[model samples]
Target: MSGRTSAASPAWFAAVRPVLAFSYLSLSHLATARDSHALAALAVGMIVLLLLAEPLWHRRPWAIALAAIAGIALWQLKDSAHIHIALLLMPVIFLLLLAWLFGRTLMPGHVPVISKIVRALEGGDSEAMMAELDRYTRGLTTIWTVVFIAMALINLALALIASPGGLLARAGIDSAWSISDSQWSWFANWLNYGLVGAVFAIEFAYRKRRFPGRYKNVADFFRRMAALGPAFWRDLFK
Candidate 1:
């Protein structure tokens, strides 16, 4: 019984860690505008997770200390309105990071992200339909890169327009051209996800028409994509 428990410990921790991390992130976002205490707790939790769970931080004690200090500072300032600055920048940074991820893979000698994903879905058999799959997946990767870039830009624009005494406002731009904070929040929090889903649906439709042999139906394609989530994350982190 002791031996079995010892063997299962690491496996159980590996399975639970990501779920906890994701839940913390989701709750952080949801509580950002509504509850300062929750946001602060989430921020500290994330910092602790990074320090304890991430391999990169294990060897860098300075980095861990700095991160903890930053987390503590943020937590201390959570009750202030200035904390909203971090909240506003979160989506913008996330979109930009995604754009960078997809764009970086398009460089010379690098396999496109979408191509890697499709290859993973196809059981790592690149030789099965090399020519067609390569071309289509590269193009799909470009599409995703462009989509993420566009989303990032739109989010930035909305944030700028909604901010009081922002660059545009300081430059004598008309108030009529500026957006409200609520409007910006709507786009950053909700419509951004909607637009991404819309793009995915549109891309799937285009793929169906362009590559009939790839998937039998939209449902099958989405199902396969869903199944590739773990592989995608593994490839992403690697």
Candidate 2:
């Protein structure tokens, strides 16, 4: 790990950073105006930046050229309100990416992703300090991987059945089962956030009961998470 924190990272870059990406996705789905669809463009671009910032920084000249090319491409599509369709595919891509990140850590030799984050946030013997906590963390990592993959699959199904330009509609195929664009948005954008937040909250409440001394409450746990600092998160995937 480089142990280097830069302006590229802050508290949001850590545990709950998915909210940063997911928020844009939700808003993009609610879009009804052309300019609003532009939000999708911005959202997707930011996701790229978030994931590749370090590599981009390491190759500054090439990054500059790529950014310029991307900007021009976006400008060319500014008139297309169909950009919001990207939101239909956004969750599938984003959640699968998250699934991969967590799932990979669960492989035989590697540390579970949640276990690593807990250790970093604790800055001590997080797993050892509590009985079976390591086992719990490993299980939690598996849960996240499964959860994200499930969410991605649901989004894919929704994208396929959604009308007014969905996969089925575009193919001139009609199905007895289908949903409206707004209805799809209702799930992909709003319901998905509720589900994710509920999961996090449920975990916190359960942890409070299971691991009483580690945190005073949920807020305290989040505060500890924030205090992990940028360096910990910057090196997380590496």
Candidate 3:
């Protein structure tokens, strides 16, 4: 597979995903008071599309049905605080699930997640390269597992302290630790994603420094990774 062109993602999707993501996240903050049904519906639709993108792209029947159900539910319950709470839980659940996925692969008999990806990407062509990456990949997988768990815990904590109606405030505990709803949204919806991106960016930089000569340049590395195709990603998660 050529790094530059093989099975690459669409340029339009690359641009639009971020825009839709931020648009919905920003609207979540705006809808914090649970007063803007229209705004909430738009955000919910964007989120549904984002979540269903992979299955929709693959034209899966069950995913389509689930998306439809989610769409109807969001439309009906857009004004409810329950919708907001559910949205808040999405990040937490997603992170913890990912943490479990990565952590499980590190068990005694199972292949570590990063090791498996590296092996698939390398196409079983080089023993020496695989040997070099084995330990590093395992350690990197551990780091990712830890990062995901830590982020999920932090997200949960913030949700608990989110004021006006969060667990702490609802219990009549007006402590200094309480955070505003808007602040919680900023961290949960925005900064959490940003931090994940930052981690990837920093790791990319360090990988280039540590594994010099493995990739031609930054673009080359990204192209090679992207060439892995959507199917590889879907199956890896499964």
Q: Which candidate is the best by lDDT?
A: 3
- Rank the candidate models, highest lDDT first: 3, 2, 1
lDDT score of residue 30 within candidate 2: 44
lDDT of 3 by residue, 152-215 (tens): 9999888888887465665678767888877887788779989999998888788778767777
For model 2, where is the 10-residue window of minimal lDDT? 1-10
Judged by lDDT against the true structure, how good is candidate 1? 0.66
Clashing pairs in 3: none
Identify the runs in model 1 with alpha carbons over 4 angstroms from their true place: 1-67, 123-128, 163-176, 216-219, 226-232
Residue-pair clashes per candidate: 0, 0, 0
When sorted by TM-score, best at the front, the candidate numbers are: 2, 3, 1
Candidates 2 and 3, the one with greater TM-score: 2
Residues 87-146 of candidate 2: C-alpha lDDT, one tens digit per residue = 668778878998998899999999887888877766565436743777899999999899
Pairs clashing within candidate 1: none
After superposition on all CA atoms, what RMSD does each candidate show versus the true structure?
A: 5.5, 4.2, 5.3
Q: Show model 2 residue runs off by greater than 4 Å.
A: 1-23, 32-43, 46-59, 123-131
List the candidates' TM-scores in order. Answer: 0.70, 0.80, 0.79
